[model samples]
Target: MKYPVTVYGDPLLRKKAKAIEKDHPKLDEIIENMWETMYYSDGVGLAAPQVGLSIRLFVIDASSGADEEPELEGFKKVFINPEIIETKGDEWTMNEGCLSLPEIREDVSRHDEVTIKYLDENFVEHTETYKGFAGRVIQHEYDHLEGILFVDYLSPLRKRLLKGKLIAISKGKVRPHYRIKVPK
Candidate 1:
């Protein structure tokens, strides 16, 4: 089943997610649903919080058809109880968008590489390092687990400029290509 993506106004999006146990009930099913919902929403990544589940889980598939980022090709993976061990290298700016934030996109600066420890769908633990677009995607999704939006990285002036637009999104005034659940 595909879950409706939660909009920015949802309080759950602002809450830090909790880590799930290895024996989390229906873990596999939830991961499957996340993938389905992500594809339906045409997002490269989706955090559990984006679906109104305050759990430490996310899914990513950065296979661009145009081979724009070759490193991201076939980079599908499921992250459960993920922890960023370290972030290294220089910071670079990239335009980032979120399933929860809808039409808003902004250039956020992030490290060029990241080392993360996480569990897979089967509860298998692994530590991996990613670079370039893959690292950016991971960092973006990881922020969701910590209740941090990309907009938070923007300057005060930039944030102020976009305040109205952000409020509009929170109020469900924006139209995204995919389905979203707005706060009542």
Candidate 2:
């Protein structure tokens, strides 16, 4: 079943997520549910906290947009307790949106490449480097585990301008196509 996405104002989104142990209960089932929720919401990436679980986990599937970025074909991955080892290359801007902050998209700047260490669904370790679109997506989702939001990267003036919209989202005044859990 698809979980209602935990929205922006939820305190869960502001807290650092916990790492998952190899023997975490129902691990496989959780991953499957996350994928279902992500696809159902038309999200390229979904972090555990976004699903009301404060765990260091996220999934990414960018293959749906492979036509524009051929390298993203089959770029599906499951990250458990991911650690970003290095972020290099010039910073670039990309218009990004999040399921947690529905209807809000902004230009966010992030590194062009990143090297990370993470365990896969089977608890197998893998260290990989990604660049361009894949790298940006990874960085975005990784930040969620750190209790950071993409809007935090915006300039002060921009943030002030968006304050009203942000509050509206928190108050559950927006109508996103997918289900969402607003802050109490």
Candidate 3:
């Protein structure tokens, strides 16, 4: 089932998520629901906090295209209690946005490549190396688990410029339209 995504400035978004202790009865169902919610919302990634859950879980599928492609495929992957064990290369700037902070996009500097160790939906441990846009998406979602937002990477001036919008979002003065369907 699709769930409501918490908007920016929600206090829950700032609280660090708690780690999932074990594979419990509803863990699989929760993860599945998260994936459905994410795809329904047209998001590349979504964290538990975004859905009002304070668990260290996030889902991502960064296999979308840059521009030219006519269609994008979902390579959905789940990360439960993920950690970036290593990073390499200089920071690269990419235009980034989030489901929590809607209608806002900014250029943020992030590591071009990263090696992350994480548990999958089945609770199996795995490690993977990612680069380019895929890597950036992973890092961004990872930050959500730690109570961090991409806007935090902005300079004081940039952040200040966006203050009004952020405040409006937090106060529910403005609502964002979530594109919930993916083109087949």
Candidate 4:
């Protein structure tokens, strides 16, 4: 079953997610459901926290952008208990959106390259290096596990400018294409 995406202002989204053990129950089913929710929401990536589960898990399938980013064709990954071992290269800015924030989109700055250690769906360890678009996507989803949002990377003035919209989102005043769970 697809889970509702957790909206902004929900405390769970702000909390640092926990690590998932190898023996975590029904992990495959949960991951499968996450994929369903992501595609249904028209998102290329989905973090466990976005679904109201504070676990260090996320999935990415950037194939939809293959037209513009040829390297992204057939690029899919599952990162569990991920750890960023290194981030190199100059920071780059990119427009980003989040399911939790609904219509909110922001230009966020992030490292151009990164190396991370993580577990796969089968709990096998993998240390990988990524650059450009792939690295950016990885960093974005990784931020969710660390209780950070892309909006947090904006300048203070920019954040102030978006305060009202952010407030509206927190208050469940916006309608998104996907189901969402707002703070009580």
Model 2 C-alpha lDDT per residue in residues 107-176, reported as the tens digit of each score: 9999999999999998999999999888898999999999999999999999999999999999999999
Winner by lDDT between candidate 3 and candidate 2: 2
Q: Residue by residue across 1-184, what tens digits does model 1's lDDT show?
A: 9998898878888899999998888888999999999999889999999998999999988776227767676788999999999999999998888888887899999999999999988889999999888889999999999999999999999999999988998898989887889988
lDDT of 4 by residue, 1-184 (tens): 9899998899998899999998898999999999999999999899999998999999999887788879889998899999999999999998999998999888888899999999999899999998888899899999999999998888899999999998999998999988988889
Q: How do the predictions measure up, each by TM-score?
A: 0.95, 0.98, 0.89, 0.97
Give the residue spans of candidate 1 off by over 4 A. Answer: none
- lDDT by residue (tens digit), candidate 3, 1-184: 8878888877778898998967555887888888888887788899999888899999887667535332225556889889999888889998998888878899999998899999987788999997777788889998999999999999999999999998777776665565322111
Sorted on TM-score, highest at the top, how do the candidates line up?
Answer: 2, 4, 1, 3
Ordered from best to worst lDDT, the candidate numbers read: 2, 4, 1, 3
What is the Cα-based TM-score of model 1? 0.95
Lowest-sum lDDT 10-residue window in model 2: 62-71
Candidate 3 ranges with C-alpha deviation above 4 Å: 66-74, 179-184
User: Runs in model 4 with CA error above 4 Å?
Assistant: none
Best-fitting candidate, measured by lDDT? 2
* Residue 161 in candidate 4, Cα distance off native in Å: 1.0
lDDT of each: 0.91, 0.95, 0.82, 0.92
Between prediction 3 and prediction 4, the one with superior lDDT is 4
lDDT of 2 at 180: 96
